[model samples]
Target chain A: MARKGRAGAALAIAAIGSFFAGTVSTILVAVFAPPLTAIALQFGSAEYFSLMIVGLISSIALAHGSVVKALGMVVLGLLLGLVGTDIYTGTPRFNLGILELSDGLNFVALAVGVFGIAEILRNLENEHDRDVTIKKVSNLLPTRQDWKEMTAPILRGTAIGSALGILPGGGAILASFASYTVEKRISNTPGEFGKGAVAGVAGPESANNAGAQTSFIPMLTLGIPANPVMALMIGAMIVQGIVPGPNVATEQPALFWGIIASMWIGNLMLILLNLPLIGLWVKLLTIPYYMLFPAIIAFCSIGVYSVNSNVFDLYAVAFFGLIGYGLAKLRCEPAPLLLGFVLGPLLEEHLRRAMIMSRGDPMTFLNRPISLVLLLLAAAVLVVVLLPSIRKKRDEVFVEE
Target chain B: MKSLSFSSRDLICGALFIFIGLFFAIQAYGLELGTALRMGPGYFPLVLAGILILLGIIVIIQGTQIEHEPMGPIAWRGLLFILPAPILFGLTVRGLGFVPSLFLTGMVAAFASTRMRPGTALWLVGGLTLFSVIVFSYALGLPFRRFGPWLGQ
Candidate 1:
């Protein structure tokens, strides 16, 4: 296996690039895509439902696990998503009789609980005193040859990131992950992947960064949020008395252009901040887990509690964190579950709309051209998963990294 | 070992899936499924649950058929500390406020590890609580209390 430190270093730096890159890109897409860049504006409910299904399929297919477990996780997520008040009927589905749950479980708290707090619990399983090498601070820069190899992957990653970022629910995380898989497959030395191949870092970093920037396209132009973050942005714009959608390009030209300018500035700031921060960030890895975990808990508790200033959110996080730990033990990856959770409401809404539009005709999904095409693509993904050669390749790519 | 023997991991996973799938399907069965076109709230969930149950049964069959890798012992230690830490924070946050709740949560969570020293845990709790209070309460201007309910915010 590749040494943990080396891989951690690469992922950490790449993560920093990705986090801001998304924020910047989302802000800029409005300015750059003059016409508001929404190819999916003509999307019908059938097409929208098909698109969400595609997302569900990709999330499961991309993750490493038995099909049953992954599907179960997705179903669980969807069920959880249905917990809030149903929009059409004004009836709460699964609020467990708690008034606090009327609006559904808080997304931020749930994410923090599952990904962050649960991760800490997992780490504590095999916890050991970390060996600190304080005296030997390694060179942060890649060698000359490293730069040469990284150039192509970075470009490829950027391109992929930009394209996928515009797709609803295909955010920076998916872009980076998909980029890494593609990079690993195309690399000359595939065996070097788990061992911290520089390309693994470079490709994903660039892709995630680019994806983060470009995902704003649908939000800016069509005003349909492609991801949860975009949903928040749309909410913010609405609150600020700015009506998003196609007319924003014509009515609010200056505001659109200004946001784009800020995206570039944000990117510049990220680069400046990252270089000096690298050393300090790496130093974090050397801290022993016991000291580290409590601190993580400290931050998580405060953060979860602060959201809506609701203590119930904290309880929700705790519950989810426990479930997360159980799922982790079962090797049911949570990433797909998370994506499913985020997309669940949309999926249901689209399905309901499509059904209503079609007057209960189940064949509508098959009949609609765009919806049929998306379903075909989803079918292709399933076929690819079942293929023995692709399965082997998936195994190779799905290692500890 | 033959490929047909039950694998512990797959069996547990399969059973869990089957149980959850059945639960949702049965519950939604009571609700109006409507026609496929009209699509009641229960329709989509019922369809998904059916698929899930089918997949679960497949996994169960696979479990019975295959020899599998051994499952790891679940870390009860980690679960004990990590699970309740947040609930404690929840119960206390409103009455005690952010600072004390976080500190207590951290201290309780610290013991999840057998290796944690009280001195280090104390320091960590203190340092993290202080930083968060300043950053979250002071810098962010969050309306939640640093100390409230008992102290009257």
Candidate 2:
């Protein structure tokens, strides 16, 4: 019945709906405190890093596309993470002298632009053949049976995510991917894995947010920044002339505690914010296609421009947009490209730091047991990917859309 | 063996990826490529470009080797909605501010059916704008400019 209505409306509603949910969820993690910090400290470096590995594996495994494609994306993300300040030399890596990018592309801008804009383009491109009408949406909430199906996956995901959160490098994003993989691997109804499985959405979401909340513990308590966000927090601390260390908890209890407390507030706010917004967002899905496409482009530009209030970003967005469109036509997933862009500098920095620390010794990776293990694991991943049996399974999984 | 096929679409895409990769690789020559074990600034990008080229080649080969779905013609009308939405949002940022601009953008982006009144779009615009303001501005403290003199401040 709704499909009889309009395409533009549906696309708008879906996009806005997802955006609202994601924003609220993220904000909630930002506000919460005691429990959040307590959660973070549970995982240490090894588990965190191991969980990261799990995340990489899972994200690659669970991707809807071919295994090779997914792995490519994972590598791309890792590569992008590598870009930026070299740990040893403190040199700017890939900013290209664009002030906005000197700090690297903002996640919000990238996320909003790539997914949001790209999606709008796709919808508009099919506007003529498509009816701008509504598809009848099913009942919003999960049924009892749905809950039963989802409950186990959610629990397993939570466990996996929480455990991973305890480790050094593992975070919410990783947890989300890892949970999805675990769900797929262990599910009785494995075939239903990617067909809008509520378990797929729910477990990963819960795990991702929970992991995000916990990632801060090591940063606040142990003074080791686990990821970019944590690094930002460290920057905030340094700007305030506070040196972060193991004793930070004791030395600045209020600041630490206050931030922690804020996280809870954020989380509560998210629940309140997201639930109601879902209705409004769903309602948006009723709009027509003609008016929707232009608006998405406008938003993309606005989002990009906000990064530095510069026109250059507009040009960059256009450039990337064209590139994005081209890649889309090719069936090359842009996710990996973005990932590579993000990680490129970071990877460089880490490799450089390890090398300098080792005094130019190539074997320095081996000297650090943790680093050695990581290297070995990376190698193993490559080897496994090359194995014919695994290769066949991977190829089978990535159905071309 | 099942039949393998490559559409014209696949060929075009492969060519573009390879082109971009080559461009990046060439530009990277100016930047230090760093050492084998110790990475420099250009190392990741250089490697990424190489991989992208390789992937492009693989995609081209795979496209050639597989049975594929037929793609439809370019829907030029659809481009109007998709292209303009984001650009307008950016242009109006400083003038209308985040909330109002968001409202306008959201409204413009939404397409009500001929049977539906404009009021539906209005309501959605109002609703989404308000929610974004509340969540991002009030809750997350994103520090976006509100309406009036505070614009871009």
Candidate 3:
């Protein structure tokens, strides 16, 4: 669209589609959250443990590359998550006499290292000058034909996004991909998709916005992060001394409602601001990657240091950056690892608590109906991913994107 | 029938997992392992380590069966320069203080790219340090010695 001098039209379509999707999905979240919270309130430790298992297993299914590699990453992440003073026993487990590590490795430092620093390093490997030629955006409004093309896709995308975003692990990314596939498959002008068909951009943009909005459902209701962004939000909540579980709705009604209200306002703000700021965004793309990365490293160091003013965390960032880069080179995805890290302590706590409650009978997982169903679901996911026919299909799907 | 060939990528990946798993397993063994109903700190990690090791073995076996892509070019220059930036910051932040330490960190990171000139790096780092001091120190009111004791501030 930009190459064809229709940048403004494309931008308008995306913004309008996203706004509509965001509004609808926010309403869905508001409607679904209370009931989900009520259901969550009834859950025991066994159910929670099974739920996390389902989450972890599904993460492996969704991760690109070898399933075994992804599983290994998850296990490695779980082990790394355990490196600190044992919560129950008060005996330090993996600190190796580093007093700074008694509180466990800082989550922010690890996240910045793995996702941020590693990505920077990867980009540096292929150093070529980026030549950006942005067309002057003139058509600020979409044509009537554009509206006719986009309406159905926007609605379908909203539905898909709202449903998938409630699932554990990274759903927004999946929702967008699914929406794009659906749009291309259903469109009469399928050949136009890669060439920027109206439905192509409209569907995935709407889907991703809706998915991002509704992903809050799992985070707010169960205190289980739906993605890494949600995990970061949970971290922020902990820092602010707010426990992020089912009780949050009742005890901190203001905060819960405030977050929901902010979603609507934020969507509105984006629509209002984005069109005018489009040129600025284009200009930002003109900045050389080389110049940008040094600033990123500096800011990352300062940000990590400012968290606790502990220099040890900064060292961890460097260490984990190398680890993350190494893992990337080995074709292991980091998403599963991060999710495992977040859920490790919680999963272990629930497992021990559930076992103690059941008097050491492992059958307790099978006996409890909710836990049994969740475990079965996890098993089903694992089995489906492992099936040779399904594995080939999965690879094809990823390759198509 | 084709002869079996192992993928070096998977072999290394599997070995790394196994090595880390064994490390954790040995450490967990040193801790007291209680019964299932009452798991000690070591029990859960020990189980996870075992699973990791098993998965590693599975990975190695799978490597022998499938043809794989060669591991591509590594960012050696990026690794040498980029990885040390944060460690350098950590080592000198308190001693050199935020201004000097951050400047040095940014300067080191800038050289990671072959495209960066020395003059450009100095300018970029200088500007970054100035901006950071203003935002992080003055506006945010984070309590850090802008100039640390080592600077006689």
| CAPRI quality band, candidate 2 | acceptable
DockQ for every prediction shown: 0.66, 0.25, 0.84
Name the regions of candidate 2 deviating beyond 4 angstroms: A1-59, A67-108, A128-157, A164-303, A382-401, B1-13, B33-44, B71-75, B78-81, B84-153
**lDDT (Cα, 0-100) at A294 in candidate 2:** 37
A1-401: candidate 2 lDDT, tens digit per residue: 12323223323332332333334433443454335455435643333343344334433433444445555554554544544454555666555665655555554444445555555556556544665454554454445665566556555665666555544445666677677777777777777665655566556766766666666765665455554455456545754678765555667887776776676666666656654564556567665554454345444554566555664455455445554665555555655445344334434544555565566776755655655575566556657666779767655634311
Writing each residue's lDDT as its tens digit, candidate 3 over A1-401 gives 77777778888889999999999999998888988999999999999999888888878888999999999988988888889978788889988889998898888898889988999989887776355656667777889999999999999999888888888764777788889999989988899976868998899889989988898998899888877677778777876789888999989999998999999999999999987877676667778889999999999999898888889999999989999999998899888888788888888889999999999998999999999998999899889899999999889879867
Candidate 3's C-alpha runs over 4 A off are A2-8, A129-140, B1-3
| CAPRI verdict (incorrect, acceptable, medium, high) for model 3 | high
Off by over 4 Å in 1: A1-38, A129-135, A141-153, A164-204, A215-263, B65-67, B151-153
Which number leads on TM-score?
A: 3
lDDT of 1 by residue, B1-153 (tens): 566578877777778888888887876776776777666667777877887788778878877765577666666898888888988988888788777878899899999998988998888788888888888889988776778587676
Error of 2 at A256 (Å): 6.2
Backbone clashes under 3 angstroms, per model: 9, 85, 0
